[model samples]
Target: MITDMTQGNPTKTIIKFAFPFLVGNLFQQLYNIVDSVVVGRFIGTDALAAVGSSFMIMNFFSFVIIGLCMGSSAVYSFFFGKKDYVSLRKSVFISFFSIGIFTIVLSILIILNTNNMLLLIKTPQSILEGSQDYLEIIFGGLIFVFLFNACSALIRSVGDSKTPLYFLILSAAINIVLDLVFVVEFNMNVEGVAIATVIAQAVSSILCFIYAFIKIPLIRLHREDMVFDREISTMVAKYSILTSLQQSIMTFGMVCVQGIVNTFGPDTIAAFTAAGKIDSIAYLPVQDFGNAFSTYIAQNKGAKNNERIHEGVKSAARTIIVFCLVLSTLIFINSENLMRIFVKANESNVINLGVEYLTIISVFYMLIGFLFMFYGYFRGIGALNISLVLTVISLGTRVLMAYVLSSIPTLGQRGIWWSVPLGWALADSVGLIIYKRLK
Candidate 1:
């Protein structure tokens, strides 16, 4: 069992709690990276690009639920720290119901307009059919993704990161094997890969829910406890909707960025995808730490331990800065080699483009670390409005920059790519300023 309260040494406590989560997040990204590698190797570069191209679109839907998950975790952590079991259960139930409704509705909407959606994004004509097939299967199983994320978030709220890691590692391993069987052995194409990915998600969802159902007593709610509680529901909805709006805007902006990348051709698309995988690895630890700190800070805040909350901030900032320095160095040094490892030189032009993006972004990776840390920190403290404002600034700037830069003759696609780091630097600076006053 992972420990929740940091009795002393907040940094050590957060690091310990976050290690399993870091591993879990890495394993999750592994599914994406490995799936792309297998498809690029066995099927073709076009197939790889098709799958990668659809990621932000998929995330657009998923992030709505993710917002609720993040919001619920903060609420649950608050209640759990106060030992208010009734409210905790209510929060959980309302979160599930809300997310369930949203997932079903959005999945249906995406499935119904699949062709139009793909065309709207200007998906390549050659790969459009494949992308549609992938989206259909993934949307069909969106509930699995929602439930898994909700359950995992709830569990982590109480400081049990290990269970989620267990499920992720198991499912990720299974996903890789299934990918080989479906795509390579049976020649399933993009649809096969997509199906395998969802099936694996289903398995993780079922296993994690079952574990929570049996072990987490809070989950076994009575009709009274599970009944819609207006106050809790309102709180969850308020924060979640705000968070969702911020994320939706961010996702919409990325979709625009994707459209820009698409215009650059498959080489740029494939390169962006491969570089993104490496970037995910670099940021994983800070993300996990931020996650852990969010719950830690929320719990401490609810308990009215102002000192503990401040301690957590210091610990998180220190850890994130160090993490940024280390990962940035590694990514900067071996970026070219990292891109090459994902795909063969003869098959994909991803290597050169990936190297360029990685090199440019590495300079601002530390800024991202600061941004995510403070974002989580504010969220944990129920300062959601502040977090949303930072997101608006960051995302708004990025989109405007991406739009203007994408038009420039000299910058072209690279200009869109540069927007990410620039946005991070600007956003983190603003976030840090606000956090300073709050601290």
Candidate 2:
């Protein structure tokens, strides 16, 4: 097997790189699916809504990790492309040190003011206690999340996507079993679900770290590698911080959107949550490809091969278009059947609402593919600033629309849901235009 990411045809290279990433992503989503199922099936809709609402808050934290890790990955990719093993090691070490400091600060802030922050979000009192409980546990386990992401990011940066996938699969299986035992058999409710996720993530992080430290020779750190190079470290930090800002802004925008969803009561929240999961599943392919393209472009950029970078962007765009066309067609064809899998309401209102929202969003799914491709391409080239600017604009549009559009009586909740695809399409158009001019 061609394990190292540096050698291969761009198309084959990306496919090879993307396969495990796809699997890992699937397992990751399982974490969400398991939580939703257990909550909806055992604890009831309000409980499910609590889990969903808390998820938006958690997603913001997720974006921070993604930003930092992506920045590190890009730097590592450049070093890997140049075949500068020493520089790659230094980049990884500096990144690990930086993330430890950053996560500790964030964890302290979260633990100290969990209630205050929850109250600020206008989290409904009905679900407040449960959501708070879940958040507290998840927050405490922040290091595990960061540990997995940083290590996985570093490994993927050097082109070892498969190893991470293996661990993800193992941990996902553990999560499912734990969820059954704790939530289903024992009836521990939201806290049980939270415990399951943290434990699973911790396990994956430990296994991933062990695998990389022992098996993947590139990552084994030495004293010499621990010394950070100021220029490379600075460059990595600048790009990573911008990217992190972009992700945080996007998550913050979603929090605003969730506020809008909350106004409609738990039913709408449950429906929207279910619909969001379906959308995430549909998005997996394009997102998977987008992730692959980032590494692909990063490696090619490091080689200073401009045309291959262009090829990667074009290929990714085409793949996303095809994928959306198929997925949207399927959702349209069997919307009811799909929603039933998540939330099976006797009246079918929740599922119907979800299907309607999903159908509307599907219209613009192709635009998401374009946006991810453009962002990945630019980010790979260390032009992450462009990606950050685009995300800020995109997030701003979503938040403004959620506030203004959802209030319109005629559109109401539909508008709140509809704003999603519309925002993606509008923002993605800007990204494509910018990429065209820059490339």
Best by lDDT: 1
Tens digits of lDDT, candidate 1, 1-439: 6355636688887888889999998999898888888888888888888987887788777777777777778888888888788898888888888788988998898899988877887788888888889989989999998889888988988888899999999889989999999988999999988898999999999999888767988656778877787888888887677767766767777776787788888888888878887887888788778888888888888788999888788778787777788888888999988987777877545788899889988877788788888878888888888888888788778878988898899998788778898888888888988988888
Which parts of model 1 are misplaced by more than 4 Å? none
TM-scores of the models, in the order given: 0.97, 0.97
Worst 10 residues of 1 by lDDT: 1-10
TM-score of 1: 0.97
Query: What TM-score does structure 2 among the candidates reach?
Result: 0.97
Pairs with backbone N, CA or C atoms under 3 Å apart (clashes), candidate 2 = none
Model 2 misplaced stretches (Cα beyond 4 Å): 1-7
* Per-model tally of clashing residue pairs: 0, 0
